[model samples]
Target: MFEVLPHLAPDPILGLSAAYREDTNPNKIDLGVGVYKDEQGNTPILSSVAKAQKMLLETETSKTYITPQGNQGFIDGMLSLLLGKSSPVLLSDRVAAVQAPGGCGALRILSELLVRCNDNAKVWVSDPTWANHIPLIGSAGLKIEKYPYFDKATASIRFDAMMETLRQVEKGDVVLLHGCCHNPTGADLTNAQWDEVLEVAKEREFLPFIDVAYLGFGEGLDEDAYGLRLLIENLPEVIVAASCSKNFGLYRERVGLAAIITEDSKTRNIAQAQIQSIARGIYSMPPSYGGALVDIILADEALNNEWVSEVNDMRERMKTLRAMLVKNLHENGSPKDFSFVNDQKGMFSFLCITPEQVREVREKHSVYFVDSSRVNIAGINQQNVETLAKALVSVL
Candidate 1:
């Protein structure tokens, strides 16, 4: 059995990270991982989280397992955070939510739910979605299909083509959508475009399974959730996978939520039971520390406001970095136009460079980004923007 096991290639992103760490170059840059860093190249813990942790330490009593659905405060807070307080869907008695280990866990649990609902369940994903989505959902024995999303020529969303393809989805099929700050490409749908997609989902009679890992990264919290809320308002059913890793800076804590909306209260209760049962079969129970921290933060008005402020600051920093990179590229006289970089939201943007160029930049210029030319915008700063721009110009 041991001899029959085959060797596997290292993950591309992790492989690049290892290579970057081994290189002794003084000026080496790393933009391969999809993590948010500050100007000092640190993933700082939010002040809100710190305060909440202190509070939990002082008052918390039990270390035993919470419910299979996890903390009620956390689940309620997440629903309000994602769908807003006044959302009509909340009052309709059609929604249910449960905590997962993280966004990936949420997605996997939802995939199991889909299979339980229909044996031949299929989910449509974007062409250039997060790399892990394929494995996380597919490994659970769900059929996967791709719809045209990113247009490489312009490095933007291929909205028309995407809509046309989605139109072909059969009734009751599941469609996976990025709620905000689309990963890998960072190109998000406008409100108008979201309206179009909503229309298509309605007409096609398919359910929307939204992945919202970077909710507050695109814009404000409310602004980023506009499309998702719009869908919840109009449609009778939808699925949401939300993560606290990026926004709350709780990456290591593995905090996430899986929310589902159904046609009526009975269905909602049944769905909740199934989700809790599925989670029990997987991780048994989500870690209590992260959920407790999140619950405390959301329950306290002052801490919640501070968290919002911190999220806003991070969003603004990314925007500024985008502008700095674009300005540096233009001033450096690069042949390629990178103004689109500023338009893209979130922490990532694909450089649209050849694989050869990417390798050349990494090996020759001490610049490290993914082989696909995707860079983390947060990895750039005032000190290194010029150097990165020059390195990119050399490759071009």
Candidate 2:
């Protein structure tokens, strides 16, 4: 029976990572996976996370299992991060939140819940979303629809088409929105576009399922969460699946949270209970270490400040790389205008390269971006931006 099991495709992003490991080239550049790397191309554990971990190791007294919803403090901290400190959305404690394994786990659990509640409910994701989103949501049994998002010709968001598509979505459908730094394609809705989207969502009566993975990696912590917060404030209820993998640099730790806005504490109590019930069977409870560290840092003023500063530093570095890369690519004399890269925010920029070019990049030059042409902006440093730009020009 085990031998007869069907073979499967590895996750495109994570799978490319294995191929990256096998490549042998001194100049090999890996801009495929969404992991963050500093100027030296090293993924470092943040000093704040390290410090919080040490404190947890010293003060945490039990091997006891955490609640099914994990640490409430962490959930609260995540809320404050997404919704500002003075947000009225938290009025009378009307939000329901749960700690999940990671962004993927939260998404999977939400898919299951969506199926459980409404089998016919459709989940509309942006065109060319995170590769895992398709399988992750589809496998849970629901209608998966693609909303018009990226415009290949312009190498940016087709907001007009997107808004038109979203306007037609039926009531009760789940509309997936990338809160910030949209995965795969970095093209996100502008502030005015967000207002238009919310208007459509309100009129159409569709739920906003926000995916916020690269918070600090985009504009800034608070800046990145602008859309989600605005939705929560203006809408009656909203859902969010947030990942600490990028901002907290806790990828292996797998810490994430799912939040649902509600009408009141009574409504929140009902929703919160359901979320825990769903989590009980999925993973029972989120891991203690990462969540606790997040809680500790958010609880402490000094540590939280340091973490914010470090996150800001990472954000600025990615922006600098984007500026430098776009400058070189424009100078590369390619027919394609690379100015779109500078406009894209967050860890990735969708290069819109074909599979053949992707192969040429991997074999001829050691530069590796995803087959869909999504490159991790964090992987670009001062030393390699020109090299990557030249490689891209050569292929073009």
Candidates in order have lDDT scores of: 0.91, 0.88
Give Cα distance to truth, residue 122, candidate 1, Å: 1.7
RMSD for all candidates, in order, please: 1.0, 1.3
Q: For each candidate, how many residue pairs have backbone atoms clashing (under 3 Å)? A: 0, 0
Q: In candidate 1, what are the lDDT values of residues 347-381, reduced to their tens digit?
A: 89988888899999999988998887889999998
Measured by lDDT, the strongest candidate is 1
**How well does candidate 1 score on lDDT at residue 215?**
85
Q: Compared with the true structure, what per-residue lDDT tens digits does model 2 show for residues 300-347?
A: 999999999999999888889988988898888766887788889888
- List the candidates' TM-scores in order: 0.98, 0.97
